[model samples]
Structures are given as C-alpha cells and as structure tokens.
Target: MSLLLEEISIKNEHSFRSKIDVLPHIEVPWHHHPEFELIYIEKSRGTLVVGDCIDNFNDGDLLFIGPDTPHIMKNEDSYYQKKSDLRAIAWVVHFKEDSFGKEFFLLPEMSRIRKFLTKSFQGVRISGSSKYKIIQHLKTLHSAEYSQRILTLLQILQVLAQSEDLEYLASDNFVETFQQRSNQKLYQIYEYVSKNFQKKIELEEAAKIANLSKTAFCRFFKSKTKKTFSAFLNEMRINYAKKLLVEGRLTVAQIAYECGFNSPSYFNKTFKSTTGKSPLQLKGEK
Candidate 1:
C-alpha cells in the first residue's frame, strides 16, 4: 500500500491563509509538501518517520519538519482501541518561506526564526525544558489572534533555535523525493518488515514483497535506506528490547526471546555490539 498524504487548507476573509491544523487521531500517511511544518503532539504515542529516520514518539513530543520532507505518524494498536483514551492531539502549522516577502528571513530581527527553519530540513526533535516551552506556545497560538499569534509563533521558533536538547533525525544525505510511484515498493517493504521484524525474516520473503530477486532487493533496499536488511532488523529488535527493558517487567532471557532472538547468548552479543551494554546492564541502567 502507498502512503497517503493530506493537504491542509485554511481560509479567511482577507487571504486564503493556511491556518494550522489541530488534528486528533489522524494517521498521516508518508507524504511531503512545500510548506514548512511545526507539529506539537500532545497525548499521543506512535512511530514517526521523518526523511530517512524512523523512531517512536510519546506524548508531548514536538517535531519540526521542513518543506518536502516525507513523513507520517503510525498510531499503535492501543490508539484505536478506545478513541477517547487515545487522546492524540497535534498542532500543525504550515507556512511558506516566501509568504511574508522576498528577504523576510534576511532581516536581523528574524534571524532566530530563519535559523530554526533552516535547521528544520535536518528534522529537529525537541525534548526536556524546551519541549514544555514549545507546547505552551503552541497552545497560545491556537487561541491568540493578530499580533499575539505572530509573536507567539516567533517565540516558539526562537526557543527551538536555542534549544540544546534538540536532536536531528534525518540522515546526512537526506534527499527529498516526492515520487509517490517510487514509494509503493518502499512502503510495501516497510510494512512487511515492521510487522514481521519480531521473528526471523528470510531474504526470500522480503525479496518477494519488493517483487525482485534477493540480490536485486538487497541492493535496492541498501541504496534507499543505507542499511542492510539484517542490520535494519537487528536495530529494530534492539530498539524493542530497550523498550521492554525500560518497562521493567521482563527478564533478560525473556526479553531476548520476546524480541525474537534465537538464543539468549546471541541476543546478549548483539545487544552489547549495538548498545555497548549487556542486556542485564541495560535493564539495570534504566
């Protein structure tokens, strides 16, 4: 299945401005647009795919995605069980860089905002104190009008520009491609891997999903994601193991088996190689 992309629209008397969309329980498909996007996710938990990066997000997570950055939010199974309990809300603001005027970003007063927008192309994920501040500003933007809303938006940008806890999520060679046709095969591979990563995934099975021979599929997947199939699967399993450990419920041996490792010994070796810590040590650290 191909990823779905929805275009957010805004209308006003003066101008057909694209007002920020405050979406709830909406699963955004992998797509890109020309407008820069600032998303404040509240009471949500899901996997966020930004550019070449794939990571999980929890409540209060904020992300700044630049123009033409292909991304989406995949809600977990729990998000759909009880709609009210899901409580997934997001404040998404979209703006064109040249909407204000031709040299707007060049102004000295707008330096911070300029920097923030430029840095967003690298895909910024904010956390800690800054996250709180941004969330507050996002709430203000939802209700503030005229000068107040503009000021609030600028303040949010300034906070992001100076935040030290911000992490870039996109890869170094992050190329923005909007070819929906090309993504069909990629999405198929992603869906299969995401669903079956817990168990052993044969190269032949993955190749069949892409409708290519094993050799061709290997080259294609690596060229697109910059990681081998096995390497990507290992990373996915390790990430799940980390979450299980943090939950503080499972023993190391149990976690290994649950995470689909054939043996506890191999799981330990892989965990140490990837995280530089034994499974027990990792659990204890948390």
Candidate 2:
C-alpha cells in the first residue's frame, strides 16, 4: 500500500551516487527515494516490482526508475537456500533532479533527455544496442573522475533518449498513491498483501495492517495506489499468474485458482483486462 523512503547520500559531496554491489542475493525490501535510479542487474533472476508493475527480472536487466517510484527486486526462492549457488550483482546509479543544475535540463539542446526523464515517471526498461552502450558507460563511471563520470552519464542518457527499444513499466493510468515520509508502515502493508494476496484479503485486515480505520483506509489506499484496493490486489494476483503461465506446468484454470480467482471465467476476463491477453492467448504467444 505504501513504501518506505530510502535516503541516499553520496560521499565526497558528489552530486550523485554510483556503486557496484555483489551479493549472494538481493535483500532490500520495497522502498522509494527522491533520486532517480539506474540499475544494471549483472547476475541473478527474480521478481521485480516497479510501481504497480510486477514481473521477472534476469541477468542484464537494465532500467531507470523515477524519483518516488517504489521498486524492489526479490531473489527467487532458490536464491535463498542455504547452499544456493546463485548470486546477485548490480551496478546502481542514483542522482537528484538537479544533478546537472536547474538550467541544464531546461535547455533546448537537452530536449531529448528532458523527455526521457519525464517518461521515467512511470519507470523504464532500456534494451537493444543502446542498453549495451549504457552498461559499458556505467561500468566505467565508477572509475572515471568527477568530470568524466558526468560526461559519460550524459552520453548514456543521450543514447537512452534516442533509443527505440525501451519498455515503460507501470500502467498508463497509474499515479503516485501516497505522501512521502510515511516511513515503513506502507512497506509493511505491501509485504503483507504481497505475501497473502493469493488468498482473499478483507479490507478490515488491510486497514489493521496500515493502522487506519477501514473507511479511512479505503480512501487512503485508493489515493496512494490510483486504484481501488480490489484492483490493486487483482493486479498483483495477475502478476503471479503471469509467472505461473510461463512455467507452463499448470492448466489455465488451475493457475487461476492458484492465483486466488474464484472462477476460471472471471480470471480469464480480469487477465485480459489487466494484461491485454487471455491466459490461452498468452500461452500461445509464448
């Protein structure tokens, strides 16, 4: 329902932050921040939640997230085993809206990058040759001096701004759902719903999780998620169904029930409405 705000500070009084993190698995919980985020997933596969978009992310996943957009990557279950061989490595970049000064992004020459950043409000997945080019620049950014890093970052943005192979995450109708500074309470609600969404969730339970009254919680949830609680929950369930569909181990009806839909017909309708494809259609496309 809500996400915690993550504060980021760069050392040396830099205007931005960049880091390469290597770990057995990603452990960060759902969160958001004021800085724009660019992350290259060097290793591992997992479920990634960006805004209301939930999907799987694999190695070489490259994307940029807008300020205050909630996101998190949870390693697949196997990655959590005691003796798991998998690992997660990432190159992460974070920068403020004014990283390049107030006038820079406003310049006519920066029109492309300006449009690109504006599109980031919904999250973006960068791909194709431009994605490879950006990864190379991100790799070198850690070693480059202050000036060179800035130049290379601009280059990366320029390439991305011009690229056609990009995917926008989150629905077009999605909007910011909650006010900032709510802290971890929203994340608690998210985690609870995510874990229990496969089962019916009552509004009172959700309100209790958020510590708000049921009447207030309904309005609060809608305001924060740009959709009703039922819609939000259904979207999440559909995301799970998407994963199970790709697994191809279960019938569509079975998958629907597993995803918490009461009937196969309703599941089919909602799946088509949400994902623009029926279960059979998705399977056929696969």
Candidate 3:
C-alpha cells in the first residue's frame, strides 16, 4: 500500500520523541516519517516492509530507519483478532540528525556517529551484542527520567556507531530512489499495485492508474523506483508470500497460487532467486 506521511508527535520537554507500545497488534500501517527512527521490537512476529525490502521480524529485532524512509511493521492478522490474546510490544525512538544542534555531528568526537548516521540512510538492522545493548538502553529508558532518557539514548548511539554487527536492509539502488518519490503519482501507483497485485496486473492498467500512457508510465516508474512495474509487482507478491510462509499455515503450492504465481515450479524458482532460499527453507527460518 502507499505509505502515508506520518507526523510524529514529540513533547516540548523532550529533545527527541519516543513511544513504548503494547497492543494486540502493530497497527501503525504502511507509513513514513521524516525523523530517523530506531525501533526495538521486544515481542512480535510479522512482516517488515522497508523501502523495496521485505523481510520477517520477530522478538528482539532492532531496526533503524533514516529520515524520509518508508517502512512499516505489519503483524499477523491473528494478532488483531478480538478473541486473541497475542500482542506486539515495541520501543521506538525518533530524532532528526540535527536534533541536538545543527553543528553537533560536525564536531570532532562525533566522527563515528556522523558516519553511522550517513550509513543509516538505507535503513539498518542491528545484530549480535549491539542489538542486546540497544535493548538494554531501551528497557532502562522505560522508567528513566527525562534527563536520563536522553543520556541513555546518546550512549545507545555510541554503541551503535562502534558495533560490528549490522546489516543494511535496503539496497543501494533502491535507496537512490527515495528522494524521487515525493511526487504524489508514485503513491497512487504504489497503492494500486499493492491492492491489486494478487490479481493479474497489466502494465497498461498500471499506466491508467498513474494517469499516463503505457510508455510514459513505464519510463516514469523505472526512473523513480529503479525497478520496472513487473519487477515491483513480483517483489510485492513475494513479500506477501514470505509472510504466509512465516505463518506456516499453508503449503508451498497453495502459497504459490495465493500469491499469483501460475505454477509451483515457477514460484519455487522465483522465490529461490529473489530470496536465495527455496520456499521450504524460508519456512524453516521462520
């Protein structure tokens, strides 16, 4: 779905904003915020949509999103059921690079952090000891005073800056497309494809949705997204397929049909090529 632009609410007393949430599900929906975000998911098992990247996230997952990045944490539908006791808990911290001051990161001591912030533009996944350290700080901030909270945050960044275990979630090619998506036409196309991808989606129809001729729309989409319409649609379907695999409620063949692949063999091949694992292997990971 098209990511809604979200306005993060930060209190006047705090230099940066934070929210600790416990709910039946992560209901934030597909959205984007201008502030850089650090999310520590203590409890949840579901899909993560970051830029053109699709992956599963479980308890202890830590994610860092750069400014203007599109992302969302969509929990399994079962968690949203009124009869279910399942819940998703998370701590999210948000701040701009200049939250401290315009010149803060330019200082000598902040060199490592400055570089870290730049690398985070593509979104980052924290792993190993660095992930645990971040969780520790987030857990402590739950009860800390305002002064202590900000201090703890700074410490967390220092650890992140020096940590060795990290993964860039989005590809460099896709990251380059971030700024080009401000035009509302891209959002319209994204929303349409997201909704209709399970059905046969022709480029002509996609062009109609974008209010352009087929040739023009194709060029525009490729220029803005760094991917062709068909490729993007495949990615979206595969993302949903991955989510279903994680759920383990359906066979691989059933998943193939459900995700719009015409046959099991083609689906398996595509899944393996896109994710570097067969559907069965991905299911095992879940």
Alpha-carbon RMSD to native, per candidate: 3.8, 2.8, 3.0
* Model 1 C-alpha RMSD to native: 3.8
Q: What is the C-alpha lDDT profile of model 3 across 1-286, one tens digit per residue?
A: 4568898888888878878888888887667777989998889988776766667788989999888776767787788788999989889999988888999989999999889988887889999999998888888876778689878988989998999999887667667766665666776676566556668888888898888999999899988877788888888788889888999999999999988888889989989988899999999998
| lDDT for 144 (candidate 2) | 90
TM-score of every candidate? 0.77, 0.87, 0.84
Q: Write candidate 2's Cα lDDT for 13-74 as tens digits.
A: 57789999999899877788889999999897988887667777889989899887777789
- Top candidate on lDDT is 2
Q: Which stretches of candidate 2 lie over 4 Å from their true place?
A: 176-191, 219-226, 246-250, 262-265, 273-276
> What is the RMSD, in Å, between candidate 3 and the native fold over all Cα?
3.0
Candidate 3, superposed: residue stretches over 4 Å from native: 194-199, 236-252, 269-286
Could you arrange the candidates by lDDT from highest to lowest?
A: 2, 3, 1
lDDT of 1 at 7: 72
TM-score of 3: 0.84
Q: For residues 79-164, could you state the per-residue lDDT of candidate 1 as single tens digits?
A: 66755555566677777787567797789988877877876886888899998998888878777776776678778878987889
Lowest lDDT block of 10, candidate 3:
189-198
Evaluation by TM-score, superior candidate among 1 and 2? 2
Error of 3 at 201 (Å): 2.8
Candidate 1: what lDDT?
0.74
**Model 2 C-alpha lDDT versus the unseen true structure:** 0.83
